[model samples]
Target: MKNLKKKLGLALAVTLSTVTFATAYSTTAEPTTAATSENVNENTIRNDEPTSDRINQFKDIAMYYYWHGGDIQQAEKDIFKGITLKGKYDVVENAFKEATLLDPYDLDLKLSLASTQIIQKKTPEALQTYKQILNLDPNHFNANLLYGVYSKVNGDNSSYKSSISNLKQIDAKKTNEYLQKLETTETILDENLNTSAPADLPQKDHAIVILGYALAEDGSMREPLIERLKAGLAIAKQYPNSKIIVTGGVPKQGITEADAMSNWLISQGIEKDRIILENKSTDTVENGLFSTAILDKEGIKDVTLVTSASHMRRALTVFKEASDFYNKMNGNNIDRNFTNVVYLDYPSLEEAHKVSKDEILVIYRDLIRTSGIWQYPGLQR
Candidate 1:
């Protein structure tokens, strides 16, 4: 009876072992469908952030080119497509917002967004953005300029007055120094022009023509045309083997002052090859920047700036600063000097009085420039 019981228990154990082995094999088996893995990858591409990230990189490149005059509308469209294509405006808004978070010190991004806000007429949002900018860089020139515009547009007289006052206080020393040098050069130039035998004027290696406040109606350098042309031409003549750049855009109703100046110079025996006309600039800053491009293109090394005695000071500062930025970026150096070509044509006592009055006005206008007129035009106080 004991042997019979032992046989029965062994058979039961074998049956239980077979059942357990079958269950274990089922649990260890993997799903065999390739479609599941592909679905996972597709979900990752749609839900993952790589697409948005690529869009941002492309947007930055677009903005860089846009700032250099390479098509801003296209850049804006590209950025719009990048953010909206993913059905994630939040992602883009967050990306720009977080750039500020990662580096709260990034004033450029802050100001850019703030400017957009102002453009959209979102006054409150723009105010907040300006506040953020001020927190980062209180002395940010363009920020203050826009803030003034903001206040002015919103009827915040107190804020506008304060901003204008602040602009006037920033830095008048550089302007004053340039004005002084211009005065000296003009005095010397005038004495030489009037003298029976021209005084031995200082020589330079190149000439810089500054287009100031656009051309006047008569194809002259605004109200004080002769002085600017005189100073610039004097420098070109002083500099042997050097040329004069007469810069201005097409005049409002007629030919440009550049063309008029060219005609006048040729009549005075100055050869056409010695005169270079930069007739595309509509503003003072462009006068320097585009002229620099021409100089670089021509492989001309030395530079001398010629403008109105009143206008020369500011021109010098802008010209020098821009030239430095350009050279640093291009990784090259050109021999350059921004000597004032003083137009000594203050012929009449009455004319001198008029110039003095104009000088006072010029000083005030120049003081307003620290606020960045180009960026915030409405704030040009």
Candidate 2:
């Protein structure tokens, strides 16, 4: 739990840095209008001023906890008294429920609420929410896509079949080609299930890429990152000829994740030339987008990815798609083989088993973003 808190807190801090919403809203400021995905001229806001402010406040708080990864200690801090991490989904649900009551036509808010419902594994509630969104606009991209994915995952074929057209309408970014190659959680888990590294991988023309996690405010390596570095060190020792690439761009105080990772690797006796710093990416998706181009330049053929098991599926998919994206632009099929060295972020094997499927399903949201649709459908990448 000590390690978990450090990891989650750093993530929250980074997310907080990017927050654009008003943390405090005027209690007397009335809800003059509500905007949907299209932001048409419809103005359906009917709530009192106080209620409008309350739901926005609740939405902000829910976002905080969502980024907090449900860490109990952080949830208790600030003015968030009486709210433990366990109540995170409840808070999220309440926020959406109130906001929807204020303006039933706000498709964006409804989508966010449906997303939270999915995270909480409230299938009935989530389906209802998605249905509500679809009822409002049958062509809504996110709602149709999510509803399709969730239905297929739960073995409901009819809804999934009907939603493909709407899902395919929004953003493909020419990435529709790689959709066939995307590995589901069911396909890859059995082979990469171990948290330990394999020793027999080839060294030449291969690279060991370490993904970065958020760092402490003072630029110190948190326990989880050090653990990943230690694992990278072991891989470096085992495959002495393999190049090491550390990718992260988010800085704290002054040091970037790549700088910190490279320094740590060199301190552990790894050669300086063997370690490459990719300090331009801000997130896992960007890590894929930026690092693959560098790999192509260095003539690296096969790549092994080192990330927490919690992040492995999404990271793999993103990097694979990144490689595909670059190849599509250059018209050269660069060989990008991704092998995984999974770090067990769960407290126990039992818990990992229990949550793995849900983790797999939840990654579709990020997958959609990777395919060029931003969180809100109106914003395209």
Candidate 3:
């Protein structure tokens, strides 16, 4: 849950957490007429971008490493089956450097590198990547939006203002709309993060919303998820009268995350009648939307969201957006915000507070999708 979710989010906050993702983009330049096939083959492993076929092959290798949190050795062993010309990259950063060197003009790849750098606490390097991204394409939508948010969060008003100007000029309607929603989400995030998970919550309209993690292939709970469940159990006992909602639909070996979570809670002495199961969602976005719909039907208003600290921000933001959407649809005056959250620090709490660049990017990305800006299924970039 903790760093695992964030690490997964680093790829595409809104994509397959444990699945491979190779976006259909070719960054390789066409071979020059004067260059021989031998020269091209030699240069493919060097700085020049390879042919489209070669880039696709590289993607299968690189994304598997990313999916496994940069376990390059395993990626090479599994994806390539004992072949990678770049040799052993002991660090994830080196893998990123290798990818960028091979496909220097890929904006999405650069963003991924910047995100990894930011997560690794290489702020100056990440910032330089952002500069390089802007240089590559001045009007890149995601680049400007994220750069703006990064600048604002880091107290660089100059960059933030400059970004805002660029965004407004780029697409005033869409950018302004997203910016407005961003303000609302930021307020919710700041207020909730400052406040601790309550010792007691009102029972009349409150529910402990526990966002679920995927189960092991054999349907057993992983350590991170077990930690989250432990935290949720504590919260449930504290607010014994409140309802509990476990949300996740991804199943492993025929066992859904919600079903396994509910079963565990039942085994731990929680009544089945008290726990509401949202077992149809495949990802966080669906968790928010489907869970909010269930809450609406049950007449629940206040919610205390429970998840890992790495996932808390995105969950809170997306849930808030979904809640607002549902409230507007139902014409209810109740403000349904995930303002109260309990986060399990999987590795440590200190690391959870440091939001990665990918998480920051996806908060808005998911919010916009929850806002109905995009109708597509998976995240594009």
* Residue range 1-381, candidate 1, lDDT tens digits: 222212211221222233322222121112221232323432111223343332333223223222222222332333233433221223223334544554567676565455445434556677788777877777776576667656655668698667656655664553343344334434422321221113343344445554544556455555466656555555455554667787776575578767877877777667898888887765566666778778777766556565554455556555654565467668988646545554434564334334343343233233334223433222111
* lDDT computed for candidate 2: 0.67
Question: Which of 1 and 3 is the better model by lDDT?
Answer: 3
Separately for all candidates shown, the number of backbone clashes (residues 3 or more apart, or on different chains) is: 1, 0, 0
Positional deviation of 43 in candidate 2, in angstroms?
24
> What's the residue-level lDDT of 299 in candidate 1?
68
* TM-score-based ranking: 2, 3, 1
What is the Cα-based lDDT of residue 206 in candidate 1?
Answer: 48
RMSD of 3: 9.0
Candidate 1 residue 309 C-alpha distance from true site, Å: 1.5
Q: Can you write out model 2's per-residue Cα lDDT over 89-123, one digit (the tens) per residue? A: 66556546666776788887787777777767876
Q: Lowest summed lDDT over 10 consecutive residues: which window, candidate 2? A: 1-10
Residue ranges of candidate 3 with Cα displaced over 4 Å:
1-50, 69-71, 74-106, 118-121, 192-206, 213-243, 249-256, 279-286, 293-300, 308-314, 324-334, 339-381
Q: Give every collision pair in model 2.
A: none
lDDT comparison, 1 vs 2, better candidate: 2
Better of 2 and 3 by lDDT: 2
Q: Please tell me which predicted candidate would have the highest TM-score against the true structure.
A: 2
